[model samples]
Target: MTHDLLRLATAGSVDDGKSTLVGRLLYDTKSVLADQLDAVERVSRERGLDGADLALLTDGLRAEREQGITIDVAYRYFSTATRSYVLADTPGHVQYTRNMVTGASTAELALILVDARHGVVEQTRRHLAVTGLLGVRHVAVAVNKMDLVDWDRSRYDDIVADARALAARFDIEDVVAVPLSALLGDNVVERSAHTPWYDGPTLLEHLEAVPVGTDPATQPFRFPVQVVVRPQAGEYRDYRGYAGRITAGVVRVGDEVAVLPGGRTTRVVGIDLGRGDGTVTELSEAFAPQSVTLRLADDIDISRGDLLADPGRPGHVTRSVGGTVCVLSERPVRPRDRVLLRAGTRTVRAMVEEIIDQLDIDTVDYRRAPQELRLNDIGRVRVRLADDLPIDDYHELRRSGAFLLIDDADGATLAAGMADAPDRYAGADI
Candidate 1:
């Protein structure tokens, strides 16, 4: 059987060794090819460095290398014997917080790196808060560059305590701290004698052993129709199928479902696992993240932008929505600004009704009634849509509850949005 896949994102402040940590993980796991390592070694020697600059493995862009800092999200894929991994190496600069949000949106785990010598910083707290808001359930705090701090047990313990406290404030329960030297490859893929006092598992061990929670099949069924497949010149000329990926739960043949926004009920007659070669096979059931075609018994009016959901637990259909927004563009978002709201495959005109408040990252407090939201400002806003949408709470259904704000004029993405706050952030104190 194939091993399960774990999606994780790495976050930290600038010069916190995030790139080095990722490079070490890939290098020690023997995931890098000889040619790639040779290129890194060549660059390191040209720069008069003592060792191969492992950071080059992830800092691939020319601008990033010239500035000696990560500027964009770098994605790397690798695997171990027991588990597969998809790592998103996010930028550590404060200005790139929006990039961090994009990377953590679909991640199940977050690897937060802290410089052992500097301890926890403001950016650390901000990243933690964002992870919590994005519903990342697991966090692994890597106190990197332990060699610079002499691998002192006391120092490591202090940093771990600080991280744990901050995580608790965000209601993140599964947090593990490990002291390691990403440059020296200590306690990353293997345990090192430099940390004889440390008793916990190595970083790789923890990643392989961590539980990824329940199967997505157990959740409520949610499939957003991407396209209606109707081919006229095929052996199956009468075929009418709704093609899309199941965003949540399990959908099977003969199950009762309702098309959202229209509230029309129908039964799934068949499911087709379409192959690009004009051949298809029937499936009894399909689960989350699987791309397939669904056929209904009745010829109902279902099209792109419509959602198929379980009848008993349907999504909310409304024109108005209240949620938090992470502004990504230089232009400020103000009341009465017209924009395009894109959720799933649907995009509709929307108007900003009110800017409720802006969040203070330091105190986790809301600044009352901000006139507008600037770049990198996270604020709560109410929006009135041109049409009713079947949206769900982000806390309950992450895929269905999330959306993007687009500039209607130029088609530039303006912000990333979540439907509602988690229980922890909903409290008055937060």
Candidate 2:
């Protein structure tokens, strides 16, 4: 039985022990098999290590096999008596910022590792800013290599203070700090007797007890119809459903709904829930975060990329949008740049209307009227869609509102943007 599930992601600078932290969580939780542990032990000895190497457990790709580093996102699943965890261990290099976005999308908490000797670096601040932008409410800061710093309270407190200041700039609500030696297994899973000055919870303790929930049933129902299910086999010839995941809210039987882009009105007739083994329908109330087959009261011009939302809670539709941008490619983004806009499950043609400003992270200076956004540079811009499309404000609903800019020729994702009110949010330094 799936009692409770918490999706989490791990991020930090390269060689800051993100993979090692994931390995520690799995090893101490007894999620790794004997054969896997034996193989890791053999490889550790071959590499001339003093003890078993846990980072080898997650660096599983052939490219990583040759480079000895994680180049893509690695997902790990484990369970305890209280809850189940879906851990997305993402690459930490500045070049792999795109992979971090893929992992942080659905995560409720972020684990940011910091080197005890380095205090706070630029990469650390970058990762923190993304987590805050993605709306992950909880964070765990692991001050690693404590043995190298002699487990000193002064060193640990200094790093904690720096991280706290960064979190404050992002306005993150929750923070937990743990002093550990990932290479030596100090305070990762079981609490270590090394830091008597630290009285806070261990890494796993915080994860196990963290409150994580993003429910659509409570807010408003938004079902972006992905497929029109019309089974024409056996006795199911009359079956029909608008298939898609619930992006924001809920859709229940007899609830009034609006189909957008086509602007059709109807009521939900029935719902069928799939349980992996077989499909089940409770036939009454269906809420957000639940993927099910929805039957409508009337047939309309609904198709893929169409939206199903609450009649009164429909999203804002506009031909133009404005938000902050971070150009991730080597080529700079300039005015009138042509790109494809991906909003939720819908894709539309769009063009870069203007570059309003550029951000200097080192000095926090937002320069006015920048010409282009270079690689790893943050800026503000305006985008004009070819046709009017519905997108929600990021502060209002994350899943229903965020968008990405993709290169039409090579299909490379260039930028990630969230919709805000006209002229962008007044306080969106994120």
Candidate 3:
């Protein structure tokens, strides 16, 4: 059996040891090379530190290394005997909250760190809120810096209680709280004898065992055509195929599908797995995340940016959508502002019809009628698209429900958007 791959993002306030925990996981897992270890040791000695600074493993930026803060999203990849892992270490600073959104958007799990000495702070709440908004189902709260608290069971328990309450406010269901000291490597990779009262899997163990969800075959099918392949000269000269990655569910030969926005029904005649060596293998079926070419029985008008979906449960087709958005660019977003909405492979012109409200991260309430949204502001906004779009509720179908707002002036990304109102905060205060 093939071990499944887990994608996770780590977030925390500045100095909460997010990088240290990631570095320790890599170090203890034997994923780091000898030269990397030697370099970390050299840097530690240069900085007058007694031990190797494991945080150096993920803090690759010079500014981060010198200033001792994560400024951008840093991705690290590693694998163990049982599973492969992709870790996104997000920035902790409030100003870089946009980076956190970018990192956590595609993650299946979120590793939230809390300083045991400081407990939960404003930034902690902000990150937690963002994680909830992104629809990340599973969360692991690492109560870090436990060594500073002398492994006090009461302190750990109190912190865990607080963290759980905060997570609950966001409707986060699966939460595992682990008390560990990233610097000392206690309860990170291996169980620490320092805490006999606590009985839970170590951080690494929890991550390895967490169940992401069912196979893509169980979900609704969604495919956004990225390229229409037509070969003119070859043994297969008449071959015409729609090539794209399956974003959700599965598609099999002879399965009936509908072209979205056009609502045209067709049957999948064949499937091809491109080997990228000028050859291809015919497939009986293909599922989510796989890049494959599909041939339809009817040569209906299909092109890039068109969606192919399960006809039985096609996605929503509409011109107006309301959801939460995190403004990323320095320029503010206001009513009547024209922007480009990129959802899946389709980019359409859209207008900001209304600024519903901005989220008060601290209170978990909506601040009514914000005139405009600035950088790092999370708010509910309604958009009017120039053309009808086939979209899904973000909570139900993440791939089909998410979108991005792009500035038309220079093609800069302005915000990351979701398809429906946040469940927890819907109708919150009008």
Candidate 4:
């Protein structure tokens, strides 16, 4: 069988050793080059450390190195005999929540690191909330720095229980808790003999085994138009094609599709994957993931930012989107505020019709009827998209289920929201 690639995000609070865990995974899998190891070792010696500082492998910027903090989402790739992996080492600092969002947007799983001594802190909960909201299905909670806590099993169990409780509130069902010390490399790559009471697999072992990217053959077809392909200068002048990644499901020659929002349906006359003859015809077969140009049977006004969906199972979307929002900026998100509502490929001007509620993550309850949303405050807001976008509930397709709000004037990327169905989450009082 072909070894599949798994994309995951590493998350936790500062000092939880997210970087070290990532480094250990890369190092153990024999992915680190000699030059990279030498660089980290040289830096470790300058800092007066006894061994190479594996965290140095990720904290790329000078500011990050000097402050001993991660400021950006560092991407690292590694592969074992069983599977290949792309790791997104996300920021641990509380203020860098935006980076976490970016890192986790494409992750199928999240490896959450926590200090065994600190147990469950606010930052841990925050990261978990973000992961859940992002629709990550699998979680491997690595309780790091366990040596500092004397590798106590009771401490590990307590943290595990607390994390499971938190995971429950956000609809994360497949959570695997493991104990590890990233600094000491316990249960990260090699199973540690020091922790005799623990029996779970190492973080590396679990990652190698957890399934990612189920076959999209069963999902409903969706293609978000990225750029309209019209090479006006060449012989392809008359060729009009919709270019985008297939978010889910299948598409093949002669299959009927609908141009979302416009609702003009067409048939897929050709499918090109950008290489080799690249035209797969046979409406019955499932087309895999690849950037392809889809030529429709009819040219009924389709362009970029339009949705191409399977006519059989068009996205059951709501006209009015209600969702929980977190104002990342210091500015407040007041009621009736107007912002751009982007769902999937389509972006529409939307109004903040109402503030239905605010969520206090610590208490797991909603503050019903909050007047305004402050920075980092999670609340329920209703935004009516200027036009209906073909989108599924966040619970359906994570890729098409959420959107980013862009400021009209300065083009600032504002809050990220999980789009709930229309008028559906009004009772999300928490």
Candidate 5:
């Protein structure tokens, strides 16, 4: 039997031991192969180190190894007896903030690392703010390098307090802090005797046991049509089905659903799942994250960009959307900038209606009315779409509420945005 999976992301300031911590997790989990261990050991000796540098296990890029810093998002997979894990080790440099955003976008939990000596710094606050904005519900704070502080409980407590306070400001309530030295493998996978004062579960323990994913019953059904399945000549010749992955909630045969941007109501007559060999399996019901072709009772003109959702809980259909954005491109986003907004499988032409404010990451406050959003800048903006879009607040459903801004001319992605009300982050309550 397969265990449940947990998707997690790591964020921290430069040299906060994010990579080392991840490397330690992979190494201690026995996820590393003998050849990989040999390679890391060989490189450690080349650097005149006594033993294998675990950080080398994750710093895969040559530039990163040379600079001893993470430059890109490195994803590593490992499984314990309890659960499987997907770890996205993101870059911590200020310039690579975009990379961190990309890595943490789909994360169910965030593992934030902090240097015990520094406590809560500006980058920590920035990451926490992003975590909150992205709606990551759970957080695990790792107060790393406890050995460097001589395993001082007072110092560890101070850091954890400050980190907790910072996390609270971002509305991250489910937070757990662990004091450990990632380099020495203390309190990571194993309980370290060096820190006998700490009683909480180890980092890996928390990760394995943390509650993940949402209940389909509680969430409203959301299905973004990816493609219209219509075979010109086949056994299923007369069939017309909407093919896509269910983003949220559940749907069953005879359940009423409404296709959005049109608001046409219909009952799900059948749910079909394709077996790779041209054979299709029909299911009585389906839920979020499942890919299936749905046949509706009535043939509504649904296309790739349309949304089929619970009619009672159908999302907003509007030409305007306001939310926070994290600029990811080198090109700045200014008022009246034309861009493409891609939400799920749907992409639409959009314009930057206004730049509401720029977030001061250090202070966790907004600087009202910024002229332009440059690379790595997080701010609020209003966008006017050329066509009406069935948008939802990110807080409602993360998959449907998130969108990407692309440069209209060059087709380069400019920013990652979360759909929300304008006043959502207008105050310190953000």
Candidate 6:
């Protein structure tokens, strides 16, 4: 049987043992290599430790190891009998919150660590807010350092309550809390005897069992044209095709599709799948995430950056957009700043018209009308687009709704933005 894949990200405040927890999970799962284990053991003895410092497994950078902190995103891959996993271990410092956003953007699940003694700190709340805004459907809270608290159930309960209440504000649905000591490897991969009252599954068990992804057939069809395929010397020399990976839903021959940015309608006459071995497979139907070349009934002007979607559910074509943005660069973005907005296959010019508000990580509230958004700041903004974009709300289609702000001068990514629904932008002045 083919194994399903799960993508997850880890976040926490400084000293919350996020790295140690990830190391513990990998170690207990037997995902570490023998050479890597030997290096960790040697390093642990140099530090005068009794056992291997599991945190060393993930804190790979020389600067990170010297400072005993995670400064950048570290990715790890492992597999079990039933499932495969991709883990992004992000930094925990408030200054590195931008790194956290990058890590959580594509995560289906977020594993947040809270120090048992600290409960929920400001950084913990910040991580939760990012997880919710990024649309991560599932969350697993690890109340670390349970050994320090002597397995006190009340401490664990209090932290879980705080996390759930905060998550509710963001509309997060599924939350599961587990009390574990990463340093001693309790309740991570194996059950620990210290918590006889706790009957929940171990951290790894929860990760393996959580549901992921939806049925592509039930979603709206969205395909962005990546390339126009035409061979000059082939037997069928006059053939023309639009090639791209279906981002959502399914498409079949005879289905009418809307080519966006131009509002042209066409029918799918053929679907061709490339086998990557210099061969092609013709199909009557294809569903998302599959890359296929499509032949249209009529020769309409189409090229890269155009979208082919189900006519009934083709997204909104708009010039003004409002949504939340997470600033990632050192340069602050303010009103009248012109930047490039890259959404899927299209890149367009956009001007920031307003800075709606900036989130206060401490109070978990919005500060209305901030002057500018700096590094690691989350805020609301409106942009005036140079061209029409058939965009969807982040909640409706994640691939279609998310965008990036790039420095027009050098192409450096300035921020990540998630668009609100079309109704939400009614009466907006851009």
Which ten-residue region of model 5 has the weakest summed lDDT?
421-430
lDDT of each: 0.91, 0.83, 0.92, 0.81, 0.91, 0.92
RMSD (Cα, Å) of model 5: 1.8
TM-score of every candidate relative to the true structure: 0.96, 0.92, 0.97, 0.93, 0.97, 0.97
lDDT of 3 by residue, 1-430 (tens): 5688899999999999999999999999999999999999999999999999999999989998999988999889888888899999999999999999999999999999999999988888898899999999999999999999899889989888888888899899999999999999999999999989989999999988998655897799999999998867877799999999999999999999999989999999999998969789999999999999999999889989899999998978888888889999999999999999999999999999999999998887888888999999999899999998888899888899999999988999999999883343565656
Candidate 5 lDDT at 390 equals 91
Question: After aligning candidate 2 to the native by TM-score, how far in Å is the CA of 8 from where it should be?
Answer: 1.3
Q: How do the candidates rank by lDDT, highest first?
A: 6, 3, 5, 1, 2, 4
For each predicted model, how many residue pairs clash, with residues at least 3 apart or on different chains? Answer: 0, 3, 0, 3, 0, 0
lDDT of 2 by residue, 1-430 (tens): 4469899999999878888888988998999999999999998899898888899888878688578678898899988878899999999888887678778878889999999988888878888877876777888999998989899999999999989888877678798889998887888888889988888888888888898786655687788888899868888888888888887776779899988866678999998887877766555877767788899989777888888888797877788888766666777788898999888788899999988787666554568877788776667788999976777877678887788888988998888776766645566653
**Worst 10-residue stretch by lDDT in candidate 2?**
421-430
Q: Model 5, residue 340: displacement in angstroms?
A: 1.4
Error of 1 at 109 (Å): 0.9
Give the residue spans of candidate 4 off by over 4 A. 231-238, 276-288, 426-430
Overall local distance difference test of candidate 5: 0.91
Candidate 3 wrong stretches, greater than 4 Å: 421-429
For model 6, residues 1-430, the per-residue Cα lDDT tens digits are 7689999999999999998998998898889999999999999999999999999999999999999999999999988988999999999999999998999988999999999998999998999999999999999999999999999998899999999999998889899999999999899998999999899999999998999877998899999999998756767688899999999999999999999978889999999999979899999999988999999999999989999988998888888777899999999999999999988899999999989888888888888898899998999998999999878899878888999999999999999999988688578532
Best by lDDT: 6
Q: How far is each candidate from the true structure, as Cα RMSD in Å? A: 2.0, 2.5, 1.7, 2.5, 1.8, 1.7
Regions of candidate 1 where Cα sits further than 4 Å from its true position: 421-430
Q: Candidate 5 lDDT, tens digit per residue, 1-430? A: 5589999999999889988899899999999999999999999999899998999899999998888889899899998987999998998888988988989999999999999878888889889988998999999999998999999999999988888888888789999999999999999999999988999999999998899989999999999999898856876689899999999999999999998888889999999999989899999999999999999999768899999999998988888889989999999999999999999888999999999899998788888898899999999899999998997889989999999999989899999999994356566433
Candidate 1: 10-residue stretch with minimal lDDT: 421-430
Find the 10 residues in a row with the least total lDDT in model 3.
Answer: 421-430
